[model samples]
Target: MSKIIDTAHVFFFVVGLEVRQEFAHGALRDTSRARLAVIAGVASVALPALVYVLVVGAAGAEGIEGWGAVVGTDTAFMLGALAIVGPRLSGQLRVFLLTLTVVDDFLAVSIIGIFYSEEIRIVPLLVALACLLALWLLGRSRQWSAAPYVLIVLGLWLATLSSGVHASLAGMIAGLLIPAYPTRRHKVVAARQLFRDFWQSPSASSARAVGRGLSRGVSVNERLHEYLRLPTALLAVPIFALANAGVDLRGGLLVDSLGSPVTWGVVAGLVLGKLLGIGLATLLAVRLGAGRLPEGVGMGSVFGGAALSGIGFTVSLLIIGLAFGTTSDLGRQATLGVFVAMVLACVLGWAIFKVAARRWGEETADLPMTLEPPVDPEVDHIRGPEDAQLTLVEFVDFECPFCAHATGSWEDLHERFGDDLRYVVRHLPHHPHGPIAARAAEAAANQGMFWPWLDFVFTRQHALERDNLVDYAVELGLDVETFTEDLDSAEVAKRVERDAASAADSGAHATPTFFVEGCRLLGSYDARTLTAMLESSRRGTRTQEIPA
Candidate 1:
């Protein structure tokens, strides 16, 4: 039963790890802040372990080796609590916390393997090392098939178990080595062609070809994460918790735990240590110019998140099992401490968030909802009359394929509402060539040919080099000398930067984000959906004019 429970824990931990990696990859835009998040995560682990050791050593307790219990945050429980007690729009704060917990979990697992594992066997250890090498090679080769990787990982787990190192370490290592990347435009186009072929000829072979094309378009890491996240979170984690969380409280055990130094050490390490460690490290990082806090996420939100990081239940329980036998007296004491700390952490987090909201006046924890610096006909590039009743604003990145796909939707809407709708374009570059492409457009706008340049560039996304941009200017009949000069001018660069700043303020993280009638659109930017939304907005405006 114990072996089965351990295997279940390892499996679910790996699944959670992959999901967390996806979040970290998407959220970490600023490299400096990413480094600060890592520093703060290290502090969260080191400080708690130090505090636990000091408290236990002071009390002369025999279970001082159990300091690893306070070194990790329960990703599941912490996220669940955050949803209940955290600020309403906590996108940036959630990013910061997710990045920090990734580091926290890595350190906790390393501690378990190093400090708690039994005597290691040399032959099995060598076998595990070879398996890890094969996994790395498979990732390097970009193998889309999941079967080869799965077989190697299973063998790695068995070898690690036989070597007497904690088997969960294999899961962590395998997950990190798995490559993750955004789907390329060419691959997506290929998949679409394959689907069309299948549609034209209905047969098992054609259907299988379509499936293979679609699977190859996405990275194996993402495929596995999507397949495994729900089952692991809802089923495996709960079962593992049930198997390990049984503690008898009859007789004097409960009373004895109240006086046990090991109990207080865990409570203090988690509740006090995490708050002070993460909070102080964040402040120091900012002061030292490591990075500023994420936009819309103030210091108050940081402290509130720090308080919630104290609910170290899942990994804490696992470490407790490894440090002391599950049925031992010391294990029960530590378990009691974990339960007490969870309650205290949640209450503390709630109080901090409430105070931050009232005292700091920072009610919104995400980017601003409405567009910043409302549109100006005199300054902005407009496609229709300035006095039009309806407005559609799009933040665009020329290098993005999805933005290219959205041009058709814009044209369809233009035909439907001509003269009654005005369209505005803003820069929100997300690719490496995005800034230069935006600058090129701005330079063309100086020549009174911005719209024509936009139409031409979207059709030639494959060739956006510097020379190609100059050729495009000549093709568009602009003064080649003036266009070249303006492309490199500081003013043109600033123009793109201003639009990007507005995008940040307006909460546009991805290209092709649309705003209609001053409200950000939430989902489905297809032509039909956008038209319905526009019609609804027009109706609402007319209704307001009818006096109550």
Candidate 2:
């Protein structure tokens, strides 16, 4: 039982949460993409289940109870193959397909929890629930350390394993409980001020401190996920595959198993079911007004992508373990069915994509030189004279790499412009830590020391832990207790949220976006290029010097 539980636990801990986080992230939104993601997940599951039933009944495999084996899309194989075609695909199309896979993962895992588990022990089950409650409180408290959370989850995993519930469910539950918002969020003035301070001082300790502050800006769940991605791919997946993928194809057993009903059922369900399920559901979603096709993507492209979705590899092997006895000949043939179906699916998908691309290829246009984003100095954190003719507003996430590039020149812009430029900082925390940086800045603003805090954040953009934030506050001579309290205040959170809403209004979807005199700017700009841009904006002349 211990060995059995450990295998699935490791798989879910690594592979499961990786997919779950993406679904949870998209599902949190109510927009069309989110709705489409949800509908796609349901459709992926339902259509495959329907197909499995028909194939099983027709093949006389109804007694086998291996129906769940055909219901999941192989996330890794499908995505890897699709990436080769991504150059010809729109960014939106790639996003939807990835999201669709995430939804399918949730469906597959849910089936394991519901249908594959054995008899349960009530006491250990209660213990697992208690562990979950403790984990929730840890996230709510914003502890920001991984050690305690890891310990708690291990306990949860153990309890879950002993309770007869699959231990993989523990990892999924822990992932869902990670706090979505930062303690306070962004600190524009504090970040800028810290950057200036660091430039003036240039000490190793402050650089290290600032690095941590920047890292702290990322939320616990997102940070954990990113850190785990490499290990999950390198260690967990390969090991799981090695253990479960070893099927004895040596005997006349291969010929005999191929003749079995389960083999035919699995092969048919994965190849045929995925194509019809994903393609038809997307069409239905668009027709019902629940979703829209990705821009420049037509029905041909949709069908092609749907065909690609049929390439189920890693995930299919996992279902084989859960739904069938691995030692049995039936399981061996089912595994063979998966491998064969995947090859056929890949070939079919590629052929469809070639025809679709040739027929419906849309010409890509050059990006615009600049766009117009909302520029309200009244709502932004302004540094420099508010009446200055050149007001540059930056929509930033402290955790974003491009924002770090832009942070260096912001303080110097003031020196160059003197009283002629009004620099406004708007919070758009697309990064998980964005909210933390925002809140830290707002809390400092309440203390009349926003610039110093903002400078600290920018200087240490790589290090934004709770302890680090507190240390920075103490270093800046603010009341540490008050600053900490304000970091968690509802008012501080609302202030940052207000900036996010404004960002949406202004069409600033991506981070490090800027607006000069209501005209938007992208990418990192040096001192010389910025001077040219300001002059162009001031003169009301559109220059092609900057690419869109």
TM-score of each: 0.86, 0.63
Top of the candidates by lDDT: 1
Name the lDDT value of residue 33 in candidate 2. 59
Task: Give model 1 RMSD, 1 decimal.
Answer: 4.8
The alpha-carbon deviation from the true structure for residue 107 of candidate 1, after best TM-score superposition, in angstroms, is 2.1
Score candidate 2 by TM-score against the native.
0.63
User: Candidate 1: how many backbone clashes?
Assistant: 0
The sequence of per-residue lDDT tens digits that candidate 1 reaches over residues 1-548 is: 44533554356345444634544455565677778789989999999999999999999989998999999887667866887899887867877887788788778877877887667799999999999899889989989987897788778877877887666556667776777777666787898899999989989999999999998998877777767767765765566567666678887888999999899899999989999889999999998998777778888888888999999877788789888866799998998898889899999988999999999976756666678878988778888989998998989998888773334788889889999998899999888889999999999999999999998899888888899999999999999999999999999999999999989888788887888887677656778877887888888841111100
Misplaced by over 4 Å in model 2 are 1-30, 61-64, 85-95, 182-212, 293-305, 362-508, 514-548
lDDT of 1 at 307: 91
Q: Which window of 10 residues has the lowest lDDT sum in candidate 1? A: 539-548
**Model 1 segments more than 4 A misplaced:** 1-25, 119-125, 157-164, 244-246, 291-295, 364-369, 384-391, 405-407, 412-422, 430-432, 465-467, 479-491, 516-548
lDDT of each: 0.81, 0.68
